[model samples]
Target: MYDWSALPRGARASLSVAGLVMAASFLGFGALVRSLEVGLLPGLATTVFIWALPGQVVALDMLASGANLLAMALAVTLTAVRLLPMVVLVMSKVRLEGARRWPLYALSHFVAVTIWRIAEDGIDEVDRPQRLPWLTGLGLALMSSMLVMTSIGYHLAQSLPPLLAACLVFLTPSFFFISLFANAKFRMDYIAIAAGALIGPLCHQYYPEFDLLAGGLIGCTIAYLIGRAGRKRSK
Candidate 1:
């Protein structure tokens, strides 16, 4: 194993907390949905592979309704498009140092909001060589938690209160926004997230499958334009 001891003390701690938070918010909901039998093994498999919550929701929901497998795949793929840029940006940061490339590819599969938060905080101080091991630890820890919690939720779905479960479903986004509010460095990200949040849902009411993927594009465009105008005016 790589030297994970190199992770900054604060970063390692922060990553652990973020992973637990994600578990509290999301794992139960996934289990509940699974228990309902609306989405079964195939859908859960997608959760492992696809990783994006929105796309998983769409896939399971559509698949449950007997939607064509090809359509389900396309929709999930579209929703996941956001990760391409995000992954690239993160990789660009650590790639120049050049650690083992294989684990980076393996770790990429587990990269999601929880791990992302921890990685962002933990890797800042670590040397380039150690960035990935720290990330691997973070990813592995969170993925294990998710798998465990989902199984628990699946079995206990009947006992868990529906109202509380609903709240749990929103936890991911809530933590996400809280992270955004705390950590947003760029004006564009702030604007883009807010616009995307508002427009993404509203657009969903009209176009459920495409709302997030497409609204994100539109919201990003508008936010970028606004940011550009603001920058020019400030200068």
Candidate 2:
């Protein structure tokens, strides 16, 4: 229904892999939700409309920590801020001269770690004339499987072993790590991720409400300033 016929052979191959990865990670998320007593339908909404796993993780973690609803939502939204630049980048890749623009907008809802990966790999091989439609098909495939896989995960939650549940969650984080790591072609991202990771918990220790956003912003700024100084001194 999303028009896979327009995709190149390579795109389909790449998208299939992406779809599989999405399916696997979602399976994990759903299981975690069930195990943790979070409702599956909310998990589905967060994954569906939000499409930001870091945000979802933060929300789940905050809720488990007894965080207030406002605080939890804020943390989740902060994590989702990463998606803005991603959406921009993906949009830039599309030539956008066709009548399929509505589909592109719709498919944007499905944009996530795995979808982005396949798009990164498949975009070049796809014909320029068909790039948008190809991406639509790819995104749709990934999105379609999530609900189905999540339902499967929900049903299987109690029966699955704890170790197995842990492994399933690895899918989301692993894909996200790969995507974020790819953004670090330059040296600055190293500083950003490292500083943020270090300061993040520290911030939580002090101001629980401001932990994520403040730490990430402060760390990123520090990293940028340090990187800038290094570059200037090198000159």
Candidate RMSDs in Å, in order, are: 4.1, 3.4
Structural similarity to truth (TM-score) of each candidate = 0.73, 0.81
Number of the predicted model whose TM-score against the real structure is largest: 2
The positional error of residue 41 in candidate 1, measured at the CA in angstroms, is: 2.1
**Clashes per model (N, Cα, C within 3 A):** 0, 0
Task: Output the lDDT of residue 197, model 2.
Answer: 80
What residue runs in model 2 are displaced by over 4 Å at the alpha carbon?
1-15, 63-70, 98-101
Computed on alpha carbons, the lDDT of every model, listed in order, comes to: 0.66, 0.71
Indicate the residue-level lDDT of 230 in model 2: 84
Error of 2 at 35 (Å): 3.7
Among the numbered candidates, top lDDT falls to: 2
Candidate 1 off by > 4 Å: 1-15, 31-37, 65-75, 89-100, 124-130, 176-183
Candidate 1 residue pairs in clash (backbone atoms < 3 Å): none
Tens digit per residue, CA lDDT, model 1, 16-122: 55666766655655654664477446545755777766666677767666777776777678767757766775676556443567776887886666556555665
